[model samples]
Target: MGPRFQNNDRARLYREIYEQHGPIAPVVLPGDVPCWLVLGYRELHQITSDPVLFSRDSQLWNRWPEIPADWPLLPMVGKQPSILYTVGERHQRRAALISDALAAVDPFELRSHSERFADRLIDELCGRGSGDLISEYAKVLPALVLAQLYGFSDEAGARLVPSINALVDGGPDALAGRDTVKSAMSTLLASRRAAPAAGVASRLLYHDYARDFSFEEILEDMMVNIVAGHQPTADWIGNSLRLMLTDDRFAASLSGGRHSVAEAMNEVLWEDTPTQNIAGRWTTRDTQLAGRHIAAGDLLMLSFAAANGDPQVRPDRGSFTGGNSAFLSFGHGEHRCPYPAQDIAEGIARTGIEVLLDRLPDVDLAVSPQALVWRPSPFLRGLASLPVRFTPTPKSTAGGSR
Candidate 1:
């Protein structure tokens, strides 16, 4: 809402916000749009759990009249036919269709694709001795893998990386980036419809419930699926890599120790989650949450980072989470990220990190830990660049071992 939300020290900012305003604090977003920031772990869980009271439909927002057509946050909170805003019975069917399609992805094939992309990305920097992990590897890897799974040609997928990055960054180019992504997905859907193929796009188009929704609805769902799938997974890779390089606890991972990769990733979800806040649940009716009075149609932003850090739940905030998986980095409830989608994201992120460590056994941060910068986004948290230096090595040839 304020500069503090985009600041690098936002972890401290969340603590301050919690200390000042309790669980649900009223805050203003860009363009002076006011909403409540839900900071408590239990409060967020309760709001997500009761989708009936806290709905996903953006039309229920009370401040739509005041929100200008040119509002920067419009792209995020704007109502659409996409599954993101869908609710109840139809939403259930759509979720099932998407889940089944994604679940059909062979885990071995998924890993194989991920490893291939990861190796290719690393190869781009392997000879340079120093490169930015964010731009060269983390920022582009997930989209490439996801694009393949979604039926895009390698060339088209390669072109999609920048557009996806721009769209999520919410920069001046965001609208243009959105347009590009829409066009690309539209083309892919049309192609798949004319001649069905073995990919998620084709699966969604020919699914059992495909008849229940229009072509436009399925198109929007595909757009949401790709955009939603890409950015956070990219951030997850960048954030996890940053943690492994900066924290001594994960130092062993750089030397081919595989166990620490999972630990570092789990720790990032608890401490430095990719999705810090989400443009979230709107109250369907007047209700009380964490003792805060709420009117019908009030917006409640879900602060995943804050909830994960909530003192009530995580009493020892400074302690490592180890193998604990209770963190709310992923939203909870019926509408939370589908289990299959979560698996896909996890496979992409984990494989990317694992492949990098295996390839660059001597990699270390090129810049001082303090010199690293985080991207300026109120809703997402990720490194702007992750420069690292390692011994120069030869690039992998096609079909090389991963």
Candidate 2:
């Protein structure tokens, strides 16, 4: 997959891929890396469900010797001690530790943090009346809240936003961004070790299973959690808001309807999920999937966007997917996004959108929907900028505002 895969109408591209090569098609990555792109819903489900056959271990990859040190995709598919590549029983324990740490985050506090950060971000642009929501609000809000949850102070949390964004964007600064994040996480871990705090970092550092994991392992897990949590949540907010503003179906939302907010968010998950494709599962043994022959150790990319739009499952793609939580946007099976993490993401994203609409009731797209641009990254789907205009309202006071 190249930049065009993300930059162009990706839905149409998925359709073309499906028609040409069926559900599982051969494709090349940025470094001319060959892999199977699993586009069928059933095919993807089968692969994710049976992790034993399609392992998560990057070491299982057969092309590692040919992969150069500086390969751009290395950061993604590179063999690391992180949970993303972990397999078997050890992976299950790691997943549980992460889930428990995240699950401890109070839902009430989570929503409060979301609203507080949402308000702070909107406060910066409410008076301007015209601002890019992606930069001014959606992009920064989730990181700010998540950083605090992970034990960063307000200033440090604010500082983490740019680095997180750059890292997720996978641009020239991605490596540097990764380094900065690692350093910040290390410092946080050290600080938490010295003085226990009420946050996910402290929980992870002192969990019953903490002693079972090494410092580097725990640190890698934290980095994975933070990076994975921030960007996709941010994109969820951006993409959902874009849908509400552009789609006539959600026009009622702009005028103070709360019900449509959830609807639009769910719809985005099915149609324009932030995470379009994942680097993916490696075949443990040669097997036939969707009638395609795959050799042992072959790489298979999961196309969630295509799977959610699979013609066999969603024959009427245009119909409203009301309360249909069957979408594979979050993956399936053991390695899927943990339920607790999904709850946190939904809380952050939903609250962000709700607060923005409540604050700027008349907010409308500043540019034509057709003119809006998407970030040029194959892994994530989100707006480069969501420029919107609303009637200028007086800034809110710390106590209360009109």
Candidate 3:
């Protein structure tokens, strides 16, 4: 029998697979589909980008048992590169709509909003000595950023946060229950119809839908964009914060103002990318990878963490320090994240971390690393709850220190 299925600790399992197989190994998953596990840096890029060998369409995984039609094992993945899942022309068109908006963003404007949200969350954490970063802070930050960007009402944005979180967690109910999100989208669309706001939704309402997309397609595209912007961005903020907290040297560097935390945030993404598993095409013909033969019709699992950690690509750094920045957490090659709208979310989260660190000089994680609970979903990696404590220095004193 092959290795037992490991849940959240994929880094461990991936390492074992690499050591045993020397990069590519024939493995049998519980579903009985034969797969060649690709772990090396070069192999991952080659297989993932080779259109002839692998198809992103899920129709290829037709024989798998765990995947139910209502609950796709991987929803809309590889089917098309529609923004996150798309490739070529479709990818370019969908990405173009949002990319310009991202490019034109004023960093100072985004930083101002992030500061406001961080202040409110800090106030909420005031009297209490500790709190769950995921619920209290990490969760609200992205929704507010996306909502403000899209011109959605505060109430509408707040309502959709949990629903988007559920969608990230993934299940049949989770997939079907996105009606809440649809309702919010419909309301926003209607409101924009009368009085358009200067956000992505409004832009989509006037630009994409009015021209290229049908009314129904506009709704569908908006629904995906809103949640896509919110979920992974939020997850990354939380994960990166936890990582920084565990390594004080890195956190201090960010807070110290010596390095550009804005740029370092990209490295944080490369180090521990929020999303874990990405589904792609099955090879239509026999292919050689890392010197092993992968037969046609075999599915492959792409592990970003494994690729990011590959020594061949990333240089050896001592003890997870704060300065190393070349990580694959942001993804690379054809499917790399577009980071539209100025890569706003990561900037916001970085600002929050910097502000928090500056104010609470003594703040640190309150529990052991092993005790921390990672969300069970294998597709993304993040802490379920990050409890932290800090010395409550007076704002006046904190300001003076800064």
lDDT of 1 by residue, 85-176 (tens): 99999899988988888899999889999999998898888999999999888889989999999999889999998998888788788889
Candidate 1: worst 10 consecutive residues by lDDT? 1-10
Clash number for each model = 0, 0, 14
Where does candidate 3 have its weakest 10-residue lDDT segment?
393-402
Query: What is the Cα-based TM-score of model 3?
Result: 0.83
lDDT of 1 at 38: 95
RMSD to the hidden true structure, all candidates: 1.4, 1.7, 4.1
Question: Which scores greater on lDDT, model 2 or model 3?
Answer: 2
Off by over 4 Å in 3: 1-10, 27-30, 60-87, 171-177, 193-195, 208-210, 251-267, 314-326, 392-402
* Candidate 3 C-alpha lDDT tens digits along 110-180: 77767766666676785577778888888777777677667776676666777776765675557554777
Kindly state the number of residue pairs that clash in model 1. 0
- Once fitted onto the true fold, the runs of candidate 1 whose alpha carbons sit more than 4 angstroms away are 1-4, 397-401
Candidate 2 lDDT tens digits, 1-402: 455566646887888889999888999987788999999999999999999999999888988888889887887788888999999998888899999999999988898888888888888889888999998888898889899999999899998889998888887887788899899999999999999989999999999888889989999999998888988988999999999998899999899898988999999999999999998999999998888889999999899999999888988887999889899999999999999999999999988898888889999998898888898777889999999999998765642221
List the pairs of residues colliding in candidate 1: none
